[model samples]
Target: MQTSSNTRCCIVGGGPAGMMLGLLLARAGVAVTVLEKHGDFLRDFRGDTVHPSTLDILSELGLKKRFDALPQHRVTGIEGLFADGIHALGDFRGLKPFPYMALVPQWDLLTLLADEAERYPNFTLRMRCEATELIRREDTGRVAGVITHTPEGPLHIGADLVIGCDGRHSRLRNAAGLRPRDLGSPMDVLWFRLPRHATDPDGTYGVPGRGTLLVLLNRTDYWQIACVIPKGGAAQLRERPIAEFQARIARRVDFLGDRVNSIASWDDIKLLEVRVDRLPQWHCPGLLLIGDAAHAMSPIGGVGINLAIQDAVAAANLLAPVLLAPGLPDEATLAAVQQRRLLPTKIIQAIQIFLQRRIIARVLAAHDDGKLVALPGAARFLLRFRLIRSIPARVFGVGFRREHIDSP
Candidate 1:
């Protein structure tokens, strides 16, 4: 790779947001370098749902074909079940060309983006490289680049603009002295995988009484289930036998008892505590924050990845002019990106919180009830109504401003 002493942009954290932003900026002819601390994308059970709205962005980028070719499941809608066995389903077909959410593992999606990024000569990916601190200009106190730990040693890469695409526990945000508002009450998720059964060949797995079962309805033949558990309670559950876990699950939803032939160890499960937080200001001078670094959303609607993609798109759209014509990234340009993105990001975060609190929490609490009346009716209503069905679609793809498709 060629070294550019005057790199135009430096993106920290090579997850979905950073990778997507790198690809977008590189395609726009900006010299961009992405720094990723991790060596590879091998982590299991992450946010994998690609909403229709994100698909629209991929289509615009001419990368949807590659995404569709991956081994994934096409989820037409989401269904909820009450403890009493009542179910509610939300159908997404009423939206646009692609109404369903595509269920692919997060690693696979990252690989696709990284591959596409390789095609752009201006894009550089530095894996196993950790960004240690931001480099601010002494005179103006504006961010100029980053101090990173490379294989060789500490290296300072100077750029016209710096972006933080790091995850929830963002070191850049903290180092910048930006105060983020926390939305309180984090929920934990226990993720586990089950082997495919002969009767479950079609890959559909869920019942009114059981927790959410995500079927990877492709050649993988693995199902990912996210069961809500008490925060910090995973260790206690790990002490129990595998059969006890299965029995507890069966008591809530009887279908799993008949379908599951054997019990597995607790090691198969992974836990995550979901929380939402957003910075009051997304930009300061030449510095900017994107994705989870700027706004973290709950996993309820599976909108985290989509929201990150949208943020990348919006940032690219707003920053292209400044990067192409300017001597430096001015405060006005930085503010433009935040002005265009903050409201939409807040709205999406709000929706995620509502779903997690009002809908998901209620469903999980009712999982042990004998009367199964709530699940079915809710499914029917969500599937039938225009207002309810549009919420997910809009969150997935639509933004604050409606622009003509012809505009750049």
Candidate 2:
């Protein structure tokens, strides 16, 4: 399946990473093609956190005014319900220009990026096209292009580089024979939305008590709920009737009243298999992997999307100039992309892993006999000082390594 079609870059996934990289390269006057498996970006239960770091990138590009106009909910901080009372663990008020996280649907963000990228003549996005396999030049053994299944039929896209932004369960990553170094995650999240009225809570809420932990994120019209459960406890939970869940919700959030019944059937719930992992090496010769394709983060702080986006920004800054040159990027250049982003990826993943084992897992593992315990040393320290709480805000809001918009 070879079509004489060629571009400067072929991005396998039109997700945050792919679409973003596509827009950056095209904006820099390099031809770029992005392939998305889905016909549209209207998918449910996707990551919706648009952190300050991501917003900073848009602001640097002079798109802040336009982006702020989009429909979004502002999250100023994250609160957890402890024995004493609700304590603030994340605060974004101290951050600069954009001091809060924007709770916008992932699809809307993708659509916005596509709209902005289309303005560039060199940007091409092929919806409903799926990458099936990678094509390696037999003589050099370096990836030259990708074979995709298009509406017409099989189509071959030849490019100087192929980036796998495909995702955690990436077919491209699998095809490339890359193995993920699992950092381990002890819990998974069940996602479902409950209608929000004018009287609902103001911001995010964490109800932790009696062997249950639930996180509710305000989404303006509705609340995106994350019911955290043991790694493989969903099956056991299903043994009980839906009424049990309704009862549990009522006990946890007294304010919700009877609204918990809105989740009448199990079909309304979607389970997100949380994964904490990263590939040891992100690239091989002419190929590169960014976003979830390179590292999969837990939904603890809703920082996965931001991490992936930063990877795209860094990748574009590094590879765009070289793409405009005669020959494709060599192995050294691809390694440099991974080298610059690897430390940041490890730093964030390490924090997530620590929280999962040190806090979340302990919360789930505890047998609640209705006895309230004092906060752990670390959590108590976080609550005792306002500045200490700000640490998490800075970590989740702006991220570890701040990548500038150098490609622009």
Candidate 3:
């Protein structure tokens, strides 16, 4: 084990939540170190949707201009296609500042955050370091540090407080004995990319076919395709020939015109095992969990990354004051972060579960027909009202509560 290095706060996992928290804390004059397992941010097919809430965050930090400069796709409205026609869900026409959700590659978002964090002298980023275990203070039995593995060897990092932002399968969450209560999901997603042409449909679109849901996100040059299938169905799909998927998916999406065959082999398809769950307890004394580390979200709204970034903002707002004064985060400080964020997290998850059980599963089980299956009564009512349509846009775009830049 390497010698211990101390900081005011140590953040595990350099995802949006971790990096955002680290940057905010560092800007508040609190020493912060962020450990990323990967050497660089280059992963593909990850969640890339930057909701209006996050865009607002960038605006608050005065980074909106820079963020807007990056290559991104803007969605003014999220539309759904049935067998007959399209239904509009989220319409961002009259919203202020940014009326659209920006879809930029997640790697670029992380890199942007890191670059800004590096501007602060108190910020430290250690890439290619994976946090393996949470170190507990023997006297108080509170987490005091993290043991990480780097290319050189085992490294011990001690801090007054440790935040776990390591994503859904976080090791720190497990080490702290925080168990996420699985909220059961009915489907998984198979993701692949196909080239985009001028004739292709514009904006983010979803098409619900009998027995399946196909969502297409428009990238500048390609389309990110997600095929929602029944839980544990990916194995069976792989058992069939690769060409079968191309034909089946293309037939469902009449607009794709055989471009679905871009999936050359099984290697091109990435299976995302959908999960909906949250940790009952997000913190223990000196340790706290944020983002997907505490709650894993379904992809229905593409709001997971946005929610995680919101969590980071809340944590920074609550915890920065204590850290800046050179004090360890007390139980109350940790609890406040959870108490403030838990409601939004729960509300979003409940909505996701409701949609999963009522709509998605039923759609997956429906037999093929020329007519589009009717949406549930509540869905129709919500979509019918002129005023209610924006509710979902607000929920998915801005969330229940918007945290402010209270730190520094």
Candidate 4:
């Protein structure tokens, strides 16, 4: 049997964007429902770096204390190994108050947001409910709701608005006929975990090795590591013996020592196909898209989650009032949200594209030729002055535009 329900706003995908938007809208007394295909947010290798801008928003929403209470690792600066030696790439010490990026697991952060949103009677979070298609108003052909497959049966939700927060592979984007332009990435990442001890490095950092770059996130007891390789390289890599991979990693990050062997088989590592793309148009008459649904970012600086949260904040600021008073937001009203967020998205993607093509591509090419790669000139210049490191820090740690919590 099919069931039906209605909400003021229905957000598909209980990701960072969906949860934050649902929470913010609910706080403003709008009835919002968030649908999640998964029963829980426990996926590994998801973006976990909560940047300073997001921290400031948490403080505004009075959730800063709760965030700080979560078990997390703090990254004060970005360091990288170069031809000369280890150099400081960016420093976050000057950002004051929340001077560091919090490396809390993404699942924990989502749970915190969900718990807070549940306090409002108007907010509903439906887990294991996969949005399958859009429900349209026959007269105007405007999106009015979504058809979802729940554990119980097929369910229909009628709403004044529908939001797509379903990440890069968004079904809603496809259903709405909205397409993203693909800006290519040079690499994919192989993710795995290794043990960390009291004597290990205190902060997260990266190593630009012979051909590939390695990023290590200090996750308290274990190191969540990303090994970047050329695009479409995972199959060839797995064909080789696992020990060969282990030896390459241990050689790059020597401190890992024998712990690299813990990656016993191919099953221990996960391949993330890196993609960069963005939608030229982010909305239609009754629907809007945000976060990875609108733009799939390269995991260069780990700014994906932070950028999505910023989108949520901006959406709430502009959307709450209209949702509360009006019949429904028109195309122009929805376009306004895209206009506000477009510049920042463009700026970040531009930087990521540049780095991928200029820096990352060069490094991998040099490695393929068995040649040594030197640090880029920009990095060398930034290393010359202590205060200058904060520029990139601000760019990555905060972002192009910082969104504040303006919605009640």
Candidate 5:
């Protein structure tokens, strides 16, 4: 394994969170290396909805044009449909510039960010490199760097700071003895891609009354669908035939029956257990946790990526002073980052859990007739009310401003 002469920051994981943080820091002229286990950016059907607040961040970075050039579908808003033909649609058009979310494939998003990050001279992207263990300074019990498994052999790289964006199962978090507190309702998602028929609109495929199924219609005749199911229900579905899976989905959302010509194979359906978890502390000494490593959000509200980007912004903003300073990050600077982000993270996590339990799951289980009538009224109120949506956006997007970071 080769080592760089001057490594300032070591970022683990090349997902959205890692890539975004790398880009932000690289643009700031910091020496950053992103180590990712995956060799390529092409992945299937990952989270794709880019929220309004995230769009605002992209615009701020002047990367909005690059993102817009990608194959994306503009979603004006989100809608909740009940089984009874009732629906609540939340129109995001009230926001400036672009009112809607953009449905771009996660692979495209990561590739785009990685490409932008490469434009910086100090940025290095290392693929197929896995972070194996956390290295610590023996005298002070402070994290010094990480030991990674490279193509040739195990390499130990020291850095001024180690940022853990390795996701929920973070080795860095575990090495730091940080335990995440679970705050999400138990649920799982069965994700699959099916051919989108000619009849399907070039928009979101939402049920009027139920909230279990989330469908995104892509450019071609292809639609990505994520259906919420019981935590361990994946195995049972895997045992059933593809036809059984199609029938089950049809029963959940009737519109799929009309738009879907055929159900993809069961193997094509990916199952992920959803959970929300947050660490007690975001940093300890020279190590820090961001994205899923710090706070894991439920996929119910489609805010995971947006929140991750927000974490990157907060980290970059807070660490800017330290990066440009004469010394490493002090306890106060680290604490400031955590302090600045804690409340907003907590609030957004609460909202995601509430939406899943109170809204999504409730609508999914309700009878068809009960869902239809209940959704429209709820949707209209939320769409028209600026306070309801904007408050959460502020919490999840910009975070507490720099001035408010030290405030109580």
Candidate 6:
């Protein structure tokens, strides 16, 4: 038997965007229901970098102290190794107040948001509920609700507004007939964990050498490492023995020493196929798409999570009033949310594309020539200076058009 429920707003996907929007709307006294397919937020290797903009939002919500209490590692700045030496690239200290990036497990962050949102009587979270299709009004063809698959049976959720905060592979986006235009990316990442010792590096840093780009994230007891390989390269790379892969990593970042042995087999490594894309339009009638549903960012600056959270804030700020007061929000109201967030999404994706084509593609080309040039002199000079370093810091750590908690 199918069950039926109704709410003012039904948010599909309990990701950063969905959870944040749910919390803000609930705070505004809107009846909000968030559907999460997973029973818990325990996924590994998700985006964990909580940037300064997110920190500022947490403080605005009065959740700063609670967030500070979560277990996390602080990355004060970004550094890169060159043929010359390791150079400080981006310094977060310049971004006063929320000066550092906090590397908290995404699960912890989601739990915190969910717990707080649950405190509001108007909010409800349904776990292990998967939205299968959009329920549209027969007369107007406007989206009216979602048909979800739950453990018990199918359930129908009727809502005045349906906001899709689902991720890159969002079913809601597809169900709404909204397609994201693929911008393109040249690399995929292989992620794995290696034991961290007292002798290991204290902070996260990047080693860009030869044709390889390796990043080591300091995770206290273990180092979460990312190995960036050319797009569709993982299959070819894995054709060789796992030992060869380990050797390649050791050759790139020698500090790992013998610890690369932790990768006993290919099973230990996870491949992340990266893509960059965004929808031409983010809404239609009663449905609105935000977060990765609206735009998927490349993993260059670890800004995906930051962008997703910002989208939620902007959506809540723009839609909460209309959602509470009127008949259903018009298409124009939903369009306003996209208009507010589209620029930042486009700008960040543009920067990522520039780096991918100009820097990464050129460096990877050295795989054929067997020669890799160091960073450009002018670029190095800008990153070397303390004052100029903040430029990259602000770009990555704080981001553009950072949103504030404007709902309540």
Q: How close is every model to the real structure, measured as TM-score?
A: 0.86, 0.95, 0.96, 0.96, 0.87, 0.97
TM-score between model 4 and native: 0.96
Off by over 4 Å in 5: 1-6, 81-88, 208-220, 258-261, 361-408
| Of candidates 4 and 2, the better by lDDT | 4
Candidate 6 lDDT score at position 133: 99
- How much lDDT does each candidate structure score? 0.72, 0.87, 0.89, 0.91, 0.73, 0.89
Kindly list the per-residue Cα lDDT of model 6 for residues 224-249, writing each as its tens digit: 88888889999998899998888887
Tell me the tens digit of each residue's lDDT in model 4 across 1-408.
659999999999998999999999999999999999999999998999999999998999999999999999888888875556677878899996688889999999999999999999999999999999999999999999999999999999999999999999999999999989999998999999999988987777778866888888889999999988999999999999999888888777777876888989999999999999999999998999999999999998899999999999999999999999968888888999999999999999999999999888877766443222467788698677858988888898889778999998
Task: Give stretches of model 6 more than 4 Å off.
Answer: 368-378
Worst 10 residues of 5 by lDDT: 399-408
Residues 246-309, candidate 1, lDDT per residue (tens digit)? 7766555455567444446676667787668888898887789988998887765677887787
Cα-based lDDT at residue 93, candidate 3: 61
Query: What is the Cα-based lDDT of residue 336 in candidate 3?
Result: 94
Worst 10 residues of 1 by lDDT: 210-219
How are the candidates ranked when ordered by lDDT, highest leading? 4, 6, 3, 2, 5, 1
Best-fitting candidate, scored by lDDT = 4
Cα RMSD for candidates in order = 3.6, 1.9, 1.9, 1.6, 3.8, 1.6
Which RMSD does model 5 reach against the true structure?
3.8
Score candidate 6 by lDDT: 0.89
lDDT of 5 by residue, 85-187 (tens): 4332455656666677788889998998899889989899989888888888899988878888878877787888899999888988988899999886656
Per-residue lDDT of 246-305 in model 3, one digit per residue for the tens? Answer: 877777777775586778899999999999999999999999999999999999889999
Candidate 1: list runs displaced more than 4 Å: 1-6, 81-88, 201-220, 239-242, 258-263, 362-373, 376-408
Model 3 local distance difference test score: 0.89
Error of 3 at 395 (Å): 1.3
Q: Single out the weakest 10-residue window by summed lDDT for candidate 4.
A: 365-374
Model 6 clash pairs are none
